[model samples]
Target: MAAVVIRDPLAFAAIYDRYVALVYSASLRVLADVHEAEDVTQDVFVRLWRRPETFIAERGRFLSWLMSVARNRSVDELRSRGRRHRREALNGDTSDDDPATLVPADTDDPVLAAQLHEAQKLVRAALVGLPADQRRALELAYFGGFTQQEISAALHEPLGTVKTRIRLGMQKLRRALENRV
Candidate 1:
């Protein structure tokens, strides 16, 4: 699919149609602004279309790689804004109308969609199994787009303590999702 997408515009469009909701959801979760999320979504897809070969199969699954791109780009956008209060992101507060919940049911590839849905469940369950402090720290860093120092200050913890929580949380998460992701 990646090879086909690199040479065929229609194939790229099909990929976009299948995964756009997930990509947009990742951005919206971090940015917490509709317009900015939309912009980041577009940027993600465009970059994928332009550089399909960058998706190395040995690294991990395509969906994981794509979501990483979306998350990183969203975080970059958040950092570029300088001195904005990411209250919603840092606190992991999501509204009822989260774009992820609104993903269209008629995706072009049902098998891929099913796999993605399963993957999301596994990741969420693993996250839920973590201790509260570790979960909060991980959420603030990844989903909230905060630096380790920023998270320490926001949560009123020592920098080393915050680092330890994030590192241990990540090790647990990686072990839990190693086979699935």
Candidate 2:
């Protein structure tokens, strides 16, 4: 499908239709703002359309790569604004937390929905199992889109220490999700 998308840019519509919900959900989970999430979703698709080769078939599944892009873009939006707590403090906004709710009701495929829920559980579990310092560093880097220097500055830790924590955290996460991912 990536090959098809690359060969025919117009064919991207099909891919986008299939995965936009997941991408938007990934962004919304991080941004917690519908407008910002929509912007990130559009940016992710545009970048893919312009640079289809970025999706290397040999590296991993397209869905995984696309989700990473969506997440990173959402984090980038957060970093750009320099706001750690931008989400609204509304009392009844639990929609973003449920994987099933993230998928549109019209396109609700139980298998894919279940897979998303399972993946979220697996990742949350892996993150929870890490040491506090490692988990914080990884969350800041991956979820907050902060660079090592930025993390060091924000956390008041040495840059080297921040880097080491992120590296160790990633290694552990990779090991934990090796078979499942």
Candidate 3:
């Protein structure tokens, strides 16, 4: 069935219909957002439709491969959203934004301000590219001013998972920036 999907695009619909619920459920479990889950579900099927040969029978079951794609894509969406917020904040778009509240711009030195702005944008993009769990944990702990315990309760995730997400997320962010330099 998986092999046939590559040859015939219509057959892909059957595969999507069979696993859409399970895939969307896994996405919602990770993301906790209905709309994001739906987007992730659509993304997962799109990836399959575009590259059906990516799934080889010798590798494993199609369902398992599809599940991995769904989870990873949901996390990607989470990170992307975070980056967008970071960009908005840096641009001084807060509802109650004041000059002092902005991300430390140097109006007197346009070159320096531009450099800082570009660096911040790079960081924002990296932050948003992180895994969804890590991005959420970092946002809550750093920007949201929430304690780890509070985040765990609010997200209804295991305390250890929250801790691990933050730790891993930070490490990945650091590595991502370092590689660029």
Candidate 4:
């Protein structure tokens, strides 16, 4: 890992070849989007290459560490998408009004729609199960597209508290969703 981190191109390439499939499968398992999974896998490898010093072998096996990094990256991507969706909503984007903007307008795909609807419901339920502060923080950050500073200002809380809420909320939501699947 240190060799890879120290700009050893061969070592880094070897690491990529060894873990790319695992990272891709993990992302796909969690996100269920092939393109997004591929992007996440690439992003994870890029981050690994850039910050090799962060990979501490004492913490766990290399595979475990890599998986943790991949999982964290995927979660961040999901949160980012959530923020974008909220921003678009605030700007008057409505999927029902213009199906083509959200999905293929001519394709009346019930199975795809149903799967999405089910996933949405599960996420909603998981969000509702969170503690009040955690749920509120997540909603403001994710659904309102507010940065941590903005969330703190809106909620009249300290920045650290807001971050804690967001972190805890996401952990709970991830655990809940993982258990379901």
Best by lDDT: 1
What TM-score, to 2 decimals, does candidate 1 have? 0.85
Positional deviation of residue 179's Cα in model 2 after best superposition, in angstroms:
1.1
**All models, RMSD in angstroms:** 2.5, 4.5, 19.5, 10.1
- 1-181 in candidate 2: lDDT tens per residue? 6555546755777678778888887677667778888999999998888888888889988888988889878877876776436323212223547565544443655666677678878988998899989987876666566678877887899999998998899999999999894
lDDT of 3 by residue, 93-122 (tens): 122423442334554346645765677688
Tell me the lDDT of model 3 at 81.
73
lDDT value, residue 6 of candidate 4: 77
Candidate 3, residue 36: how far the Cα is off, in Å: 1.2
Candidate 2 Cα misplacement greater than 4 A, ranges: 2-14, 46-54, 82-107
Q: Evaluate all candidate structures by whole-model CA lDDT and list the values in order.
A: 0.83, 0.75, 0.67, 0.70
Supply candidate 4's per-residue lDDT for 67: 83
Spell out the clash pairs found in candidate 2: none
In model 4, where is the ten-residue run with the lowest total lDDT?
Answer: 89-98
TM per candidate comes to: 0.85, 0.71, 0.45, 0.46
C-alpha lDDT of residue 81 in model 1 = 78
Per-residue alpha-carbon lDDT of candidate 1 for residues 1-181, written as tens digits (9 for 90 to 100):
6555557888887788888888888898788888999999999988887777888889998888999999999989988877555765665655466555676544657887778778778988999999999999988888778889999898999999999999999999999999886
Error of 4 at 66 (Å): 0.7
Q: Pick the candidate with the highest TM-score.
A: 1
Regions of model 4 farther than 4 Å from truth: 83-181
lDDT (Cα) of model 2: 0.75
